[model samples]
Target chain A: MSKLSKKQKWLVAGLLAVALCFGISPVTGAMHIMEGYLPMGFCILWYVISIPFVVWGFIQLKKSIDANRRNMAIIAMCGAFIFIISSLKIPSVTGSCSHMTGTGLGALLFGPAAVSVLSVIVLLFQAILLAHGGLTTLGANTFSMGIAGPFLSFGIYMLGKKFNFNKKVTVFVACFLGDLFTYCVTALQLALAYPSELGGYSASFVKFLGVFAPTQIPLAIIEGILSVIVIIALESYAKPEMRSLGFIEQEA
Target chain B: MVIHWLWVLPFVLLLIGGLIYKAYRHRGEHHHHHGFGHKHGEATIAVDTYAYHSGIAHWNPAFKVVLSIVLLLFCVISDSVEVSLIIICFTTFVTVVLGDLSFHHYFEMLTIPLVFLIVGSVIILINFSWTPMTNVILCLPVFNFFVIITHDSLYVTVHLWARAFGALSAMYMMSLSTMSNEIFSVLRKAHVPALLIELMNMIYRNIFIMADTQNRMRNAAESRLGYVDYRTSLKSFGSTISNLFIVSLKRSGHLFDAMEARCYDGELLFLETEKPLNAKLILMALGVVAYCVLVWVMTRGV
Candidate 1:
């Protein structure tokens, strides 16, 4: 490395100040790959990757729908819960609030594949009805929020169960990691699409992570806490409803 | 070389302005003393209301979907600044003028996506290097690495921003003019899996009811001083969501009972208003495709 001249030092200081300003700044946008953000090739690739999971979800849904008359209404209710959760403002430390991804809770309740199907519909609603996300980027968003996050969350919950962890601790960790993983996957998607000329994809990945992950950290913790509280509340007041929904096992 | 760096100033300014404006608006909306009445409810319902009331909502929904997708594909694939600009203006014209959406509403919706666009593009504009280069516009050294904004990165940022904004406008046009129920019906007619369509219809039906329940619960919490502090707010929000979940479960059970009373089957049949695809709509779609091709051809090398 070359020695920094006086001018270079000034430039460095100025830029650091700017970067710091942005670092602490509140996030105003929801976390979705905006329309046309990805190139055509990447968009197609994500759709290809996400389709199988969504299809599997569809098959599972069909089975359940076929098994019972009320399945459709129950699934639809879960999907609606997703929409409401996303719209609810989870107050952040920065004063400006962020929307919870809400997939983790759905995953915890109905399992991952089921949430994937519901998430695609909810994503479509968000794209068209809210103008927050977009049509072209739906596949990418679905993969992150719907598939990857939920699958890991479901897996972690299972793991927590097998390891005989506290139920509340399990719920909190599962939800928190699920939320965090969604942002990581989003950053990865962006980095793959727009790699930097200097240091390539890895560097681009770090930069994207730097931009998004910090803001998401607190939100993830809050989501975990919120999920735990909801689970506790449900166990206390709606045990029979939970059992009917098949989240809790029915007694012999 | 330094003068070339000035091009990034407007983006930086716009970003800062948006942040300040967002923070200002957020503060304006949430008064801690009042505790709970805010504008969150209106936003969720805003775009849908516009779609239902749009001037051309009665048009064949499938045609509108096709037109927007075609235009969107062109915008994304062409990656030409001029073509993107044309698409943006054209779609905005369709949405605000012909579709009769208010200019204010259109612009407000546009800004939501623009937040992500601006952030992503700006990130792409920045480059990291281990050693200093000659073409660096702005450089910062963190440890041994130099974080710099380069000319090429700036060019990419502008191009990406334009392309994204163009596709977004096209999507907005389709969304603003076409109701989602109509789109679902169109999908059903197009033979998308029957299961998916039924689920969508049901979900669409449930969303309003849940949102209303949520709003009421939130109001109840506010009155009880549930959100007076951070911890209380968390507890309140959690219970509110828990209540919403329980309510949804009960409501679904009730809905099933009501459906059973009507001798219902598994499938849901929606009565759609038939809108014919007229010659005018086809001609207009063809016109858009032709315009896109013309712009593509003209801007080939640029």
Candidate 2:
């Protein structure tokens, strides 16, 4: 196999970073930490702050749309689809239930940019109804789960594609890694914010690993397997739809 | 649970002050964009930014360190309702005064925990377990406060709404300002395990992708009139969810293929964007250490 280029190496690095963060501490729910726990001044500060990145993502989406109108719509539809599916929860241990975020699928399809746009929308809806995550945290949440996750997955996907690896294996690795990355970042964020409460980095990181690994690791593997299965199904049954969505071309 | 008057007083004062500060700041800052007039908007933002930007975003990291240390110390030293109340009141006050948040916001945030506190305290009082006088004194006032303030019932009928919004607001502030990417950089620099770091990155990326897919499916379902009822709609929803899982699986497969094509060898590398630690940041670290020491000294006897 050919060696990775500088860009690919950077991509891998970025992906690994995201996975470690999320895996260490999965951002489990739609809304993370609620309002009024931290000092209110801090909340207002972050709200004003995350605007630039959100705007930037939209601009990127616009450019992508202008470049490929049909593909853009399909991508947008997929994004919307993910938002809806993830909202539905399933029962889990600890009297709490878990739901699928579907971010891994987005990364596999239209790449990370599309996932960014979708994340903003999903978080918006969640804030309105369930109030799981607050409006203030929207930007940060978007940056963490939305922007970082898809980008990492896409980068991994591209690397796998270049290497001529088995298609199924490539997808499995990408999805698993992407799902894991979200949790790791959540842990790190928790460590930073509640260092004393969380018992500093070492303690918090260990606690996060201990708390999340049992649930999240298995969840990642399940998600990865599910993603691969879905892709296979799409290839077989919905080939036309997949092609329209730009998952595959007639030549491939 | 000996609630120290002094300990409780500081906690309440600080909390209220923090809230007021946030509320005041929100009123002055016209730059803030509350897209939907959500309650506790400013407070939420403040908490999110504090969480996200605590260490890296040119802010005083010592503030968070000190605050956490204080909270922990308080938790350890004082285990009484009086102390809890004092801490609650002080924290609420800080939230209101310094944070510039509304009283209603604080009330709403504390509503759930308040209920639990009241019920548990009352039960203890009724049972006459372990110093009935203490229980009666604490329970009556708190219950009375809730009754006078909100006029809610003490029965199971009262909703047990999770304190999700308040908790999320705090969590958000913590996450928004801090860059997760920078965090990984810090971890790697600290020589943390490479495997652990790799896992974190992968999981994070997949969350957004999963969310995106879920969103798309929801829109499609809505367009097709899939969410009107409970039973049929749930079935359809189940199918949709299953379909999403399948789609995710396939996508992951494709991504895996792509990675292999690029010659990925399971190892990840990257460049660092952070500059050398500045004097101010170092000082901030030192300040955190000093605060820790101070907290240790203050709580030594307790």
Candidate 3:
């Protein structure tokens, strides 16, 4: 077998990290697409949709490990990072609080494919151990927060970097937008399952968006700031580690 | 308008806060057994601790999973709330009897999802509209609106809630009785690809180590008054988190070294515990299937 390239390795590591995050303790995110929230058919459909992505993630992971065993620790670290950082709850607003997904940072650092898998692991553990997310709706949750959020974050980050935006500003915007869009995707998912009589899917989506806005807007801002600060802190304090993880090039 | 939107917040938050408080107290009370991870999450202990028992714990993981999943499916697929509610009662009885867990503790754990079901049901109950419809549950002054709960909506809400409760009960039965690793073995048995399983095991092992590291770091920061105010808290949180990431990367490096020293193959290996099948096991399996049938029969037409 041929050795995988650096980009391939990251892709592999991210997929493996999904399985890794699945192993984390179940101190989960609050009120995730909880169990039984979606109907039976919806749940099954979601599992079907998500399982392919999850399997692809693991396949990528196996290839990575077979190519190089040392990548195991890197995979573990990314998984741990997803678990702990996303678990951190900053006060979202007044009455309610939402957790920073840590997806923005993970996506920017790891790529969306890896983050997609990692998010599933995080959501799975959240559903199982913490009882925050639902086991049945894992697919829908994975699609929304896992696949969608990271893709947006990665997309935005790439675009910003390509446009020669300041690294710090790019990180902030990516994280902020990533956080906002996670809720947006979540709203869409929820609406899809339970469309309102008032306006059907679009209206229900808007309603969920409205409901999430008060909390998620503050959360987006908090998450954005947090990601930027973390990036800066790592760049300043752990330059070598960042370089090791390929999160940064050779230190300035 | 504001009152209707915001009313559920206090209620939900209070329930959540109470859960946290209870977990905190329970952790302090039982810290000797759990060590540091209890503070971060008590549900880990509360729900999973019973799985170690030898009662139904000795049963086949695949069979147990099938049984639970079937029950869960019934709960969801069934049209009758009566059937779902009956399922809730049945699973509750089995879980308590077979698992030998406290009824109070079991019910307490169940309440969190019950609360979620209530909050989610609210969305089903109300839609923003000017016209008042039949079966209005509450005519609130919010958005010049009333909660229009017709018979059909009521039936759906109650049915969904019951299904949720029933499915949860079924889940509790499986989770409470089977060790997590056993569940992993079931995944393995189901031929869920070796790479994913190994990776999951690796990550699962690492969760404890990360928790230990994070717990120590958090304590150190707390001692330094890192969370004294909101602003300081954010700054401190940012630094601590980044520090943890750096530390995690380093830890993984060390872990890789250790694995290499152990002649680490990528494969994770664990011996599955074996228990001889007996009539009791058969009876339990039969009883569960029978119980399921009985449930459908009793509440089918309702």
Candidates 2 and 3 compared by lDDT, better number: 3
Per TM-score, what order, best first? 1, 3, 2
Clashes of 1: 0
Task: Sum up the clashes in candidate 3.
Answer: 2
Clashing residue pair totals per candidate (backbone < 3 A): 0, 175, 2
- Residue-level lDDT of model 1, residues B1-302, one tens digit each, is 44433433443454455445545555645433312122555665676778888878888899998889988988888886666766776777677666766555677676556755665677898787787777567776667777788888888888898889988888988888888888888788789998888888888888889988988999899999998998898889999999999988999999989988888776777688889999987987797678668756755664
For each candidate in turn, the TM-score is 0.88, 0.44, 0.82
Write the residue-wise lDDT of candidate 1 on A1-252 in tens digits: 356788878886787667545433324346778888888888889999999999999999888888886878899999989988986777667776588889999999998989999999999888877766678889999999999999999999999999999999999999999999998999999999988888899989998888777678888898899999999999999999788778898899
Best model per lDDT = 1
Off by over 4 Å in 1: A1-29, B1-38, B140-145
Q: Is the docking of candidate 1 incorrect, acceptable, medium or high quality?
A: medium
Clash pairs detected, candidate 3: A35-A134, B1-B142
List candidate 3 segments past 4 Å from native.
Answer: A1-31, A91-97, A250-252, B1-39, B53-55, B134-143, B294-302
Stretches of candidate 2 off by over 4 Å are: A1-31, A36-53, A67-76, A90-96, A197-199, A250-252, B1-302
Model 3 interface CAPRI class: incorrect
